[model samples]
Target: MTRAPWMAVIGLVACAAPAERSLTADPGAETTPVRPTHPSGIWPVTPPGADSPDTPDPPGSATNCDPLHLVATDIDETLTTDNDEWDLQIDDPSYDPAMRPDANTLLQGYAARGYTIAYVTARWDFEMSDGRLASEHTVDWLHDHGFPLHGGLVFLAPEPDHDGDEVVEYKSGVLLGLQAEGWALDWAYGNAETDIEAFLLAGFPDDSTFLVGDRAGELEVPGIPNEDAYTAHLAHLASVPDVRCE
Candidate 1:
């Protein structure tokens, strides 16, 4: 399938807030502009030059940026890449990415500006929040690194109650269920086509639900805010405009 490319500049509203934001807490204030990229300053890295290629624009001709909300990015692509995660979780007792360079700077920027930085994923479920072997294993793995997720909703392999048709339908129903429960969701970011299904369910009406990474022909919706999964995830965040936390 042909992927759509759309670019819509969302309006930015600057606001004041306390620094030293906590990753354990949810979003609290106005959204901030994208920060400068922080550098690990490793010699092996290639410093970006003046002749770098243009960042790819959004698809579907882009959507009008929502003034009230900012984009939500995928953890794998936007925060860290597959390779990096692999290294961290390479010898996982339960298989979780280390998430080095944590993207704390970026997340902090968003938090200071009041924009919600949600770490959306299909990793696990609410039932696993505590110490369930499955949940504990996944949570422990992510925590070992610095994922900076406030809360998470895990998807434990489709349900046995749903029929073939219902399986897809139910995966979506989960989001609606969360919202009905009063989860504070300003935006969403996730990987994969099924990941976007919730965007549609939640109403594909804002820039808050941006896509990151290269899924190629897997999706039809326009994912703005792209990033590299696992290995490149940190590098991509490093490529963000004005990122300076390091």
Candidate 2:
């Protein structure tokens, strides 16, 4: 997950708004916002219009208190191999590639346990020069790899106005937005230092953040030498409780 020198240049154009498109399991499917639900014997649900966004509600409150058990993850080297030769242009013949070994399996395991998955990447929403939306291709890639594309799965990129910000800034904003919308981030995974920085900025505890590859973090898993560390991390996640899904 070493930062490529060219990434700085790409970052400038990468933060544009994503194309007006839907990436749900079915085309044209309407996105239903997740509602807060009470976890059995865990926390009581807060009354509607009773919680404030500016302050943290007690655990189980309708706003900013429900434990959604959401997991935010980065793409590229974290879930897929960082194949430098791959180019995402519409005409590029090498666009489709396999997910990192066991990546799908691990993700599916989380999905099976009722955790919501958010694919938050710094990749451009669309190629700025050509106006070709990379999000459509990204959706296809996730579908092709058998990752969950239905309920609770989301792909987030920088908004048009915020595209020029650093990856950490862009990602942190997205995470914060999700929190504001009542999504509780329980875990975050990334392969870059920026990922860790973003998660921390979004209020994820150091212990809940897992970093794969070379950069240091609270949990640094060896991503280059072998993927065993990632496998072990998945095993570790199995013990975590799945929050109420509503």
TM-score of each: 0.43, 0.64
Q: Which parts of model 2 have CA positions greater than 4 angstroms off? A: 1-66, 83-94, 127-132, 159-165, 216-225, 244-246
**Candidate closest to the true structure, highest lDDT:** 2
Instruction: Give the per-residue lDDT digits (tens) of candidate 2, residues 81-140.
Output: 663423443457336754667777777777666666767777655563434356555655
lDDT of each: 0.36, 0.53
lDDT of 1 by residue, 1-246 (tens): 111111111111111222221111112323222221111000111112211112332321111123223334444444555535633543443355534244555454444333333333333222332333333343334444543232222233232243434433544454444345443345555555555665667554444454545753346643533433333433434333331121
Q: Which regions of candidate 1 fall more than 4 Å away from where they truly are?
A: 1-80, 83-120, 124-132, 149-171, 204-206, 216-246
lDDT of prediction 1: 0.36
**Model 2 TM-score, 2 decimals:** 0.64
Model 1 TM-score is: 0.43
